[model samples]
Target: MAKLSLCGGRAAVTAGSRLLASGLGAVAGGERYTNNFFLYDCSSAEKKLPDHKDEDGLAMAVGSDTILAHAFSSSGSFFALTDDNKRLILFRTVPSWQCLSVRSVARRCTALVITTAEDRIFVADKSGDVYSFSVTDPQGEARLELGHLSMLLHLAVSPDDQYIITADRDEKVRVSLLAAPHNIVSFCLGHTEFVSQLLVLPWAPDLLVSSSGDQTIKLWEYVTGREVQSCDLSTSHRQDGDEDKQRFAVSRIAASCSGSHIAVLFDCVPTVHVFQFDAASRQLLPGQEISLEHGVWDVAFDASSGLWILQEDKDEVVLIYRLADGKWQRSLNEESMERLSNHLRDNWTLMEGCSDTESPFRNLYKASYDNMAHYLQKKEERILEQKQKKRKGAQQETTQQTKVLHPVTPSS
Candidate 1:
């Protein structure tokens, strides 16, 4: 017997393997249901596809399994997925799962991501065609078309979903605006090969990070089209002999919500690289590194709980690491513990007067403005005072010279 947890639910029970074969489905306290199925029978357990549909059937035109890869919005009101079957799919997540499909020339869908704020979805395909869809209305419509001739490998939307960043096999990373449809926006150019992974730092929306097959990780300012930093992981093990030179490759990248740190995982190696971002120097410093037995495929941080979730490629088990105590825990279930921990940690106040303080940079900017105004005022006063003193001195000197020259007698 194997136990499987429901999607967004806490209950877990040991059920016969038959349930697993039939597909484990769970609905998280709603009229809608989330079905976890596999694209094929041979699909790995870790790669199970998730399908979200409304049980009430308010919007029934979009059928099940119509999306290739989909993700629900934060509000759970809408969901976006890519079919890449000559058309893209945008559907609602409620009981009435109304859907809209956009036709495209790209036959193979590689990656897709949705914005957090607006009702928009960015779809990228193997042919490098990136399309943006707006789902504000029940009928999803194509809002913008970003022309690209290369094969897009990965895509990541900012936390606010205001920006969409795409990495292509043509060795280019593009940043586009979700709010402004006409703007293609910025480009991050440095990788000599195909980019394998793309991640946006949640703490800093302007920061775009990417890893490439060229054995390097590059950071960019997504708005200004500037390459901020680049880390060459290829030479990470230079001291080792040439026999194992090409053994390690970066598989995934994740940044903490505070934007204070980043984690990078390697394909062959079990170790995860933690890089600390220094606000003072604006640089990433090497931090503590941890190793596991299995190759890590993905890494996610629950900011509220201060926990890090690492998914391994070889197993279905998710390793949970606590940031506060540096302890390791295992969970085969998807419970509310993560959300609960986040709520508790977020509301806990360890020190008084710490909550209202603004960031140092903000305070410094305010202080600088005040000082500049005061300096200008004082400068003007000093100039006026000096002019008055000089005039008085000159008057006194002239009178004394007149007296010495016998002009005092005439005045008397």
Candidate 2:
């Protein structure tokens, strides 16, 4: 299952699979679950659908569409999603949620970013290429923007729309000119593993926040490729497990519009770490740890700075927390929460085989193998065996000599 905070936190979207027992559905489901997309407007306490001309057909066809990446334009006036079908779907959200266009991508997309201009959307695919599509011209052909040697994990655009930031499996954060992507601006280097998430601060356009499989969240001056600060997740204490010794990849990072708060969620970990951004000191200070009853899937900070969480619980899949008296308290949009949770619970079966999907971060971790040490140990064993063989041969020779010398005595 996957979830995204959308429409500047006024809405959220969750993706899961629905079990299909038939031919095309079963083939589309493959080893993964079938895509069953749900979009909820938190403010209105209702679900929204893509206003496609053939809305009914779109709903039926989406059962096989596994969304690989999605992002909302900086202004939240536009939303975009890419799927395994190699299709990019754009939606306009200003007046009402409606499908703007559906275009084909070069390859299976891994990440997406919409420029602040709201005119173009950038898509990163598993083949290590980024493609640009026009938001204004729905039928405009996709243009090849840039290429990476490794699969791109995430993409972020500068608020000014001058620079495009991309993170890849090679642990590189690249800053490139939006107009001329071939012109490299700088590279934000330091992460030793795959960079999974990237966010250009909404409030501080110059500041870039990135998370990695290396178990660290880094802040960067993206334009200059300078790392500002880093928070290591290994040191975080979680009461439930030996988390201090365990390493977890940062799956999501979200910052409040006020720039005062940042929320981070570690993959497979049930706790959310809220960090206070000290603008005065230019520091990210540890703030609060909100432990959940079940494993968390995703987290986002709403426009009001409220934290919304999607977790593993079937009964309560959606959780919203607000800061009150310096503590994070559960704030219920009871009706809204119920509707969202029910939608997930009713289709929980679609998420059953999801555990079989290999986590991309797992391979990002450096593998340790001591080939030299094994070779040396085998060499030592061979030397010991040769020594024993020689000893046995020497003993047999001595026995033979004794028998030859004592032959005369035996005859007498």
Candidate 3:
């Protein structure tokens, strides 16, 4: 069998397979088991054409605060998700959609990635220890691999399989030999804040790309741990001095398969910064900036197809985007560059201002607050408000949903 999953689980962590393999019905049978692993026959599930009008992409219904992180194997066949419950659920692609394993760790699982060669996985916890689990027997005891001083933000394995690169909350990226993780390779230094994501360029295996809460996207050599280039993106997305009050940090960053484009996402901002990757100069040049209706929670690129997926805040579905003319834009094609620009003028209505009466207050991006579902939910409440407006005295009971405690991270 061609294993679609890379062995170790880390950022660039493969969580899904683009190939929905055919001829799935031949082995379609009742429930089966292999060494306690449940087999899934995807063909057996009642299938119907998905409605286009419905929300698109692989939508995780987990509340915004509940989902910590999601990863796909380097091969994209296997998918894994770590939730607030500290449970890691692994899913298989070929032959069927089945839950291969569910491992409950002692502490919160922070980051994970599949290895390039073997089919095993590595998981990092908030407590700073790394553990390896074999996909074949994931529930079997996990072997402790390594540990970090601070909370690990992200990790990635080198393409040559010679080393493992890990980034922590305290602005450090450690390089260690894969075979002997305790043996240090070198440290890729100089990130002032927490590193959010790491990418080993596919086209140039020697180059590594990283984004950080320090408001920078940096490139470096993972072998010698030498800085190649760095770009401060604080002013790249926002222009005027008006943005001084609100702090902007890098939430996520992703690179394309060919390493031609890079995606940058920030906290509380609805814009996606597109940077053109200069493989020759080992630099990133500004390209396009695509603004969404809401801030992005996470971003992923499909290496096989060259498409992008964005998880937006307060949205039930993951939005699918595409690269057009060297820039990342909405895949739906309904929102053009003109439309995106129009949003700045028409959609953003300044409602809140500072007491100084002269200082420019933050722009309340209306799209973030104008949620369609929220509006419908408030329709009945609006009717009640009108009724209460007329009635002498009417009791109003507010229904509250328990707020899920979001994971605390250096970057987050």
Candidate 4:
């Protein structure tokens, strides 16, 4: 669901297979939040979304139409999204953007991914269960593929379609065979906090990258459950006199189409840390820290390897950065980019009735409260009571020893 909460407003952007998708939520007329989902064809500059009324001639459910999860197939031929209304909408994007099916899911979906073969779309709902729907049959049933003990936050399939990776709020990343999802391959388990995002490296199919509320990103070899590298954001990015700053949780993780760059956004933070993946060294070298004027909502790398950032700013809802000469430079004069920015700016609202709210990511961090002082104080009190009891016993023994001592002295 992008973990986007409806406070002032919410925006999320994702790019895959030459297609860019954005979901925007805004309060309308000081009442309920109305969300709009947009799909853009980056190559032809065309845009689309579901814009039809129901068969009963009733209006669309404005509040429940918020897109929670969306993705394009690896081949860019199909696109799918799961809305808050539990409607899984699939579109064929090859010839023309056409709605193929709109099936009802059992629960609200948190994440979804389309297979490279474009056969099925695996959806993970908040119920911790995964269901696969057929891509060819419009009237197909959603088959229960797998189940997790905790709520799943993200889902991804390997390039070879052999394994499916699932991340949950229990700080677990499980790798399972796609055909038999119950047969677990391995568990990539090192996160101390809730795992937020997972990305199977496009170039290195066996390696996996995951971010967590623990303020660290880890690279894992999923088949063997080996940790290749772990980078602590709290320490690696520390600046002068910023030691006391809150350890920011990772909100999103994205990579370029070439798999040479990785971008990470922190929850409620205005900075985006870009990493250059060193294939030879198998390391994530720190690249650029793009500081924004407002808090970032989401980020994605396009098919052309352009970095797109969606922010909370009403004036500039979207920004694009391109890599030039080993540095990221802002690209501001593209016509299609301007059109997208203007469309989003027009839909953004003041989002009245919901403000001053804490981030949803705050609850993911491990709770901490120490009672060691109280425990030590009680221990000291017990020690003092024991000493007092021993003192009283000694005094009573001395009182008896007075006569006993006189008798002993007489006997001596």
TM-score per model over all chains: 0.57, 0.79, 0.62, 0.74
Instruction: State which candidate, 1 or 2, has the greater TM-score.
Output: 2
Clashing pairs for model 4 are: none
Model 4, which residues run further than 4 Å from truth?
1-63, 236-242, 349-357, 369-374, 377-412
Q: Which is better, 1 or 2, measured by lDDT?
A: 2
lDDT of 4 by residue, 307-409 (tens): 8787766677678899988889999875545655665555443221112235657766677766898899999999999999999999999989897777654
lDDT of 3 by residue, 22-55 (tens): 1211111242211121222222322232222214
RMSD of 4: 10.7
How many residue pairs clash in each candidate at the backbone level? 4, 0, 20, 0
Candidate 1 stretches with Cα past 4 Å from truth are 1-69, 72-78, 83-106, 141-144, 158-162, 179-182, 235-244, 247-249, 305-316, 325-412
Off by over 4 Å in 3: 1-65, 237-246, 303-321, 325-330, 333-412
Where does the lowest 10-residue lDDT sum fall in candidate 3?
Answer: 1-10
Candidate 1 pairs with clashing backbones: 58-96, 59-96, 304-342, 305-342
How many Å off is the CA of 2 in candidate 2? 2.5
Per-residue lDDT of model 1, residues 44-79, tens digit only: 112222333347745324222223344556544554
Q: Name the weakest run of 10 consecutive residues (lDDT summed) in model 2.
A: 20-29
User: Whole-model Cα lDDT per candidate?
Assistant: 0.54, 0.74, 0.57, 0.73
In TM-score terms, candidate 1 sits at 0.57
